[model samples]
Target: MNLRRLTYLGIAVCIASVPVLAVPAQPRSVEYRSPVDLVLLKNDTWLVVANQTSNSVSLLETKSGKILDEILCGDHPSAIVACLDGQHILVSCAHSGQISLIQVEGGKLNEIHTIDVGFEPTGLTVAPNGKTAYVGLVATGEVAELDLVQAKVARKFSVGAWPRYLTVSPNGERLAVGCSGESKIVIVDLIQGEIAYSSKLSGGINIGHLQCSADGKYVYFPWMIYRSNPINRDNIRRGWVLGSRIGRVRLDKQEYREAITLDVPGMAVADPHGIVMDSSNKRLVVSAAGSHDLLVYRRDDLPWEGVGGPGDLIDPKLMQDRDLFQRIDLGGRPMGIAMARDGRTVYVANYLKDAIQVVNIEDRSILRDIPLGQRPRPSQVRHGEELFYDARRSLDQWYSCHTCHYNGGVNSKAMDTWNDGSALTMKTVLPLEHLDRTGPWTWHGWQEDLHDAMHKSFTTTMQGRPASPREADAILAYLKTDRSPPNPFREKDGSLNESAIRGQKVFAGTEANCISCHNGPHFTDGEIHDVGLGSEEDEYQGYNTPSLTGIYRKVRFLHDGRAGSLEEVLSDYHSPEEVSGTRAMTESELADLISYLKSL
Candidate 1:
């Protein structure tokens, strides 16, 4: 009961509320279309959208919005779950790694099987007796499972480095997944298929869509914070980088607490790209997708509970605001969320208004919205086929490193401060289709390559100014052949991550030593470590030790946001000695050394 008296008794039970700042329910001009992901089959009366760049999967009928069948496939489909008794489906194509299986019967969609397995498959679930299906693959961190009575592949496991979402718990044994290029979640152990546990939903930033609840206890996730500062002035090249919240993570005792967190005062836009769990009205649905909206929380208003330890969730008044959820203006950009039989009605898939919005979790309402096509984006294909992209080169509206690394950025906070010698603020963005084998770019390594780090991040930090230089070589040829977005927490092949195995025994032991330099596989051993917060006499004295991959969508800590959080970047700037490599520990061992640098 001590750790500062349980952090003053969990901030006096989370400062008794007082954190509401939402306001953006007045722009209703809805024509709808942008369905990224949704599925509420059968009981909710069918809704299935996975339309990424319009390859197609429509089929909505939830009480008359019509469009009861679009069913095309391949070119892009991107993730969908349900199976057999629910009417068999399983789609995941995202630029063709393929995995269709459709078989709806009476209400259309009968395409049976397609199976390919490794290049894009971008996450899809169905193994709770639905006859095994997993998928994920995304540039191979691996997962594939499948064998729905011999549909194919049946086994393959790896787990980390870029999984987007998996979930199969409600007594299905286990299989958590969620890993957007390193920062941990990887549970896996479904009847010993492997990886028996690991957690740290990137409190540093960049972890997305992990959802689970039909009685699995709790697991919802979708965080992204990508900060950047550069020299602030309400955005020098882009830094605020908001939205995307809902951490939760409890699986009996896997831990990592402080459930909900997303405030939207004035214009912060909750962001959150997808999360689902209506579980018949306990409610959780959140695809806050950059403030276009569709959020809702309930679950007795989630906040710190048993799984609350790492800096034990410093009470920022329990976050959650995008106007207290229950709002639906499905005009465009609403990532994903799914539920059917008894979750009290749910379904949303509106990536830039391709359409599919049938919510109504007990009057928080929206109920009918079914349009689909022309540059939409959702996939989990199965025999339909016809996805093409050209919404003016969709990076959502181009120039997107997700605006400044949002969704795939984990959970951001802010602070770019011009560059390296400034200190460091979640400075990693790796995951580039296996990142040309991790080369030299920012954080002091400074770009000596990758086309001069894509001409200083596409002409001075993504300004683009009418791009040129061949549209930055077609956006670095589409970020080196995109498709690495599905890692669903890879691990089922040997495990590790009990606070990173007690944070690698205290990050290489000796109270907070931090392995002297951080180590490899992108955890960073690139060098440079001064710590005294730089600028003693400049000339790059030290700092460049970035790359924790998706460092929990970093927002601000040093390099200029000057430690706004992450337990104040380790209990007020690395405590141990004074030389300043910053890591002496204390404060519950710096939340187990940041839960072991987020289990990377």
Candidate 2:
């Protein structure tokens, strides 16, 4: 058998023979369209997809699934929605912090205007009147309302941390925003122009897209629940460690919330995203991105009212009924879903395959996969990306690396993986961006070799077969491509503010002594220290010094996620007085220090 060797970040990796694509001498004008979301337009005759990676929108013929034209838009187009007029489309470009207004005429997409909203404009929804639009800004934790008539942002509403998805009521009286970082649904009363209430999910994390019922009575979403139990085979097989759920809550009140487990004994649905309901509201379809399948359920037949216990949410008997539930396996990672007027026909944005999959919900069969365009040959990084998002790598297809480290970022939850010779010791997930620079792996700083760490994560943490040497190399190559998003707190030119500049001196000063541990290119000394936050159950003596890069993106602070904010971390836990034996930081100093950290 032939073998190949590749070096990534100075680490030599040997792998099985695989064809490597050569880079073009000159940069290509067109890029790969990694479609993330789509919407039907013009009486379902055309489809528009938000090409996430390409930063463009692709207009396609619905019947033939042929690309009519690709219109360039803002950066990182995350979501798309058609307006009430059916001729205008709204796409939220996350990274660029702008909304691209597209006009559809003669089966072609034209970018009419680009409105600067704010940072990380993701989830988008248009009101019934089509005069107003709501977008969720992830970095700032707020939702901006766009006045479509003026093609500008009218006002913004503070919802919560990491507002990733939003859905407006049929009557346009309320908006349900999915705040993924906080694991809650914030209801914004549009008439009153304020937040009515927020329904918190006890153990929910990675909240998926939100959808409102046609009648405007309830909102539905898919999310994952992490059970704080010891990581073991029995607990994992029984769905106690990490599980998937579809939750429902009434728009009128805060107390009427219900959830049903999508996992059944051995078989589990992981990373449930992109949900849709039939016209009659009888069928509910969800794309299980991690599991690489679609779960179709008879919504009326589901026992959503007081079904199961705490750890076990699903009734075992429900799994035996095929009429109530059916799983349709799609090869690529299925994301956003769009239903045609003929409710039985559902279109899905297949992320990994770079195509739009048309499926018939009635027969639970795939009609066809419409490739967006010609894709480049498979490279090592692309191959690793598939494996990273592929849940089949786990036992029974429960979860994938994307489940915890979402989009190569943190999941805002503490998980016990039994990595450090102890059980039930939960540690907050560390972001994977610039992962190579932040090693020695694990919270305990025990794993010295990155290759061995990746192997252990698959075999022990996922409770699945260990990845081969070649597979590990591919995964590492993919990680190299994962870079941290631009910090929104910084200035437009990426310069630090006055407060951050002042705080930088304080960080290096002996009074704070932060630079002693967190001083490097990635803002970490790459060493372990005893900060006195350990517990009796902890097997490790000290925790690893975490990198402060993109620290503002995190919702929870500290190793165990005890601190809810940077202020809490400085005041309540891990204070300068406690860590460095210096005097407590004053409120003014703390504010400046936090500002500097966020600027990083």
Candidate 3:
């Protein structure tokens, strides 16, 4: 089936499955206090959940519901996977690009070894035989394997774009890696160390987390398609920041097939956050970050029916009264998931909830909820060296200017919603890499100097202290290395979309006249234009065209986010109402121009 049809079918099943019940929300207990990742161990008696934000792990007594111990790790600890014996833990610290080994014996944890990896090791898994542990480097397209026996590096292999989470098959012959950048899956033959197979999905970008069915017949990974349409320079800016879907691939085959994929049913595909498999009873659990709900799919039937038959999956007849087995409400935003050995329970890590959610698998019931930390964002590792401990910012509480503008690209989609939102308008967050080279801050090009803009924006908008002369210098030091997130959407063979190719012709041609300013890798000529489009609030009629690197992550266009879509902007030049004084263009030309802008 086509991706659109598959998406609808999955949503239809979910919608049909709902049965009304007067179920009361469960009470909150066993606050995580900083829970990151969880693993079942010691014959299912103990559960170790990574408290990465707080640099520790919470040991839990599963049967007794008791907190056993809180073992500390150094710096930013992220993912955690257990050894085959379940007596040790491997965690990655992306901040320092290091992986840490923590030995667990007799209910206590001890530091073992620290091995340095590449940029941002976010996902990890131990081989079935407990001989090798694979680590996914988020920023680098590579996987690093650590030898379990010696607790040292075994080997590393290059893979597809921005590998996030990885999984090993039960027999230990095959390994699957998920790439967020290219929206593809690469399966490697462990013995031969060669990529045995690969599956590419359309609308598949930013793919996260891979899960293998208990029988090892099916492999599942969450696929997200960023909305891509290039109609105008403005719409190209909006890009595909928001996405949707839960996708599965057949592993036995050498080629990838789109099987049993589900859309973000009741909600806009904000982010398909997490995936976990309950091996005991054949349950597939997915956490939808947009809806903040845990979705359950049962494998008793073919194509893994949802709650109801086909259309009933959304509101499954079998799950109407099964609160514990269907959907569970996480108090806040849910991001990650892990299952217990027996499949009787599943653990959820909430990014915004600041806690870990424990759910009973059989009845779809939430058995316990534990509070873990503040602002947990899918951590997977712990490093041995204290590299980040003495950094400028303290461990407990210090948010960097870069925190908001990740990798200098403003990776997030949040708007400046402060009361004085006008001053901190869309133009305020202009890219800094090309500054000095690119004049002014904000769309209006109001502040000419870099120092003034930083001081005013940080103090007024961020509610941050106005940096002292020395402090401002330090902040500027951090801002100077501003580089945009790399573009993975460009075709693999280096071919541009046909429409985008046409659009490119029109862009530089006189018909569009867009190339007068927007050009280069940054996609901006660092020049301002009147274009005859501005509001009364546009104190300055002209604005600097911002860089296009990762423009898909941006939400607004122009100085005030006035343009809603790229198509609107391209078509606006023709609309007397919106375009006002700009030159008019035909609809076909507009579409072609939009296709071109998107190629960028």
Largest TM-score belongs to which candidate? Answer: 2
Runs of candidate 1 with Cα error greater than 4 angstroms are: 1-34, 39-45, 49-59, 62-80, 87-124, 131-163, 167-178, 183-189, 196-350, 354-399, 408-458, 461-463, 466-573, 579-583, 586-589, 592-600
Q: Which candidate achieves the best lDDT against the true structure?
A: 2
Q: Tens digit of lDDT per residue, candidate 3, span 401-476?
A: 3323433443212234232235223332444555445564566555677777656644543334565665556555
Listed per candidate, the RMSD to the true structure in angstroms reads 21.4, 7.6, 17.0
* lDDT, candidate 2, 1-600, per-residue tens: 112221111122333244544323222223467889999887788998988876668888989877776655777889999874889899998876788888888865666677987578889998989889999989889999999888988999999999999899989999999998888989999999999999888778888888888888899999998888886678888887889988888898776568888886677788998998978888889999998899888887776753343346466556788868888999888999998888889999998888899999889899999987667678899889999998889887788999999898898888888787788888899988888889887888988898998988998889899999999999999999945566778887889999999889888889998999998988998899888899889887888999999898899889889989999998768788988889998888899999999888
TM-score of 3: 0.58
Off by over 4 Å in 2: 1-30, 306-317
Relative to the unseen true structure, what is the Cα RMSD of model 2? Answer: 7.6
Candidate 3 regions off by >4 Å? 1-34, 229-243, 261-269, 300-325, 373-600
Candidates arranged by TM-score, highest first: 2, 3, 1
